[model samples]
Target: MSDFTREPFPDRIFEDLGGAFSMGCIGGFVTNFFKGMKYSSTKMEMLSSGMLFARRAAPSLGTSFALWGGTFSCFDCLMAKLRGKEDHWNAIFSGTATGGLLAIRGGLKTSLKSAMVGGILLTIIESVSIGINRKTIQTPRQQFKEYQRFVQMSENQDKKSRSELKLSEFK
Candidate 1:
């Protein structure tokens, strides 16, 4: 009861859920509206069809996004608690759990496949993020040191070229 009561982190779970839902709704509305326009011939028909499609699709898309964001965040929190650390493993496990849980109604095989796909996708995303951050993050002092090293190297190269030219001229 005590463990359950205390949240490990005060996070953006609700925010993520709501944000994803809103984005999904917007995407759904735009996509369906354009689709409707494509199928309709007259201007009035296009507007009618677009409105109809948007009204029908927006909520459904938003709900799907809300489910995914909420479930993923919940699983991520659970995994972080179990692992006792916030890391890529948490994301991978959460992705697997969310996918499996979401696909449970389909069948066991489908759930398993979904789980694998989710885990792999999360893993790849995490790995790429790590790679990209490796060279991008530098403190001001580190940046200055790198700059100084570059200047030193340039000066040494200039000096070497000047000396080589002098030697060649003497010969």
Candidate 2:
């Protein structure tokens, strides 16, 4: 049977915590690069400072993402469940919004060097995430297709078993 239990509150909170800190880490790296390029140390400070700010902001963003993700996840899960399948695109928009917020928070450019550095950091985060997830999770279409194939295989096996049993009477 499929598990339909409400996702644990702690775990959802944990995502928020992790997301903020991870974004902060990205922020720090970006800040360091800016510092190297002769950008004002103030900008670097802001980026590092943004991490702490992010920690404070995390609960809000996390709760928002979770609520949004949960609501959508439930709806998609229902549609897929009733249709005898699963929908994997459910949380995508929610995740994108979350990522965009992370990118914008400390990655904005007030000047040329800072802009270049910020843009680079944002690109790195986005590209790396896509690459990693691509290696990990199946795309929604792929997931749905796999589920359909499994169902078909099960049905075919049932048909084969039934046919063999019916023919056994002649043996």
Candidate 3:
């Protein structure tokens, strides 16, 4: 059986919804933190202001989450059906569509700009994550050997520096 066939649809929808909600909340928090810092005089004031902004931003954030979740889920599902499997390119196209739709309230120009930026950012993030994950799967013994090599190199450099200092003293 295919991987998608093994997983039920409702579960996938729920997972996407949860991820979208979390991303929206985090984005709101970070945006408000900077806004608060710009307006508030002290650290305490910034904290208080950010919290207040977040409270006020909750409804809009929730709406954003719903929209993004629905759009991404639909597009991803469509892409999966077309390609017979999901991949990073599917994610990039879906993310770009989501971004553009999310900005539809602003205007066509804004939608295009948001789509381009969001697509680029998503591609970069996905590429970096893939690269990191690929490099992080070494065995414990391999990691230890790499660390030892690094230490040995550093020690050799230190000894060379010490020998140079000793030779300078004789001048």
Per-residue lDDT for 23-114 in model 2, tens only? Answer: 55555545544454453356646555655554455555555545544443444444444566433332343343334444454554433344
Give the better candidate number (1 or 2) by TM-score: 1
Candidate 1, residues 1-171: lDDT per residue as tens digits?
123443455455776688889988999999998888888878779989888888899899999988998899888887777877677788888888899999999999999999999999999998998787777888799999999999999999999999999999999
Model 3, runs deviating above 4 Å: 1-8, 26-52, 138-171
Ranking by lDDT: 1, 3, 2
Decreasing TM-score order of the candidates: 1, 3, 2
Q: Which stretches of candidate 2 lie over 4 Å from their true place?
A: 1-119, 134-140, 169-171
The C-alpha TM-scores of every prediction are 0.74, 0.29, 0.58
lDDT of 3 at 41: 76
Model 1: how large is the Cα RMSD against the reference?
8.7
**What is candidate 2's CA lDDT for residue 141?**
95
Q: In lDDT terms, how accurate is model 1?
A: 0.86
**Candidate 3 C-alpha lDDT tens digits along 1-171:** 144453455567667777788788778877876776678878768778877777677657866886779777877677777887767787788888888988989999999999998789879987997798779878789999999999999999999999999999999
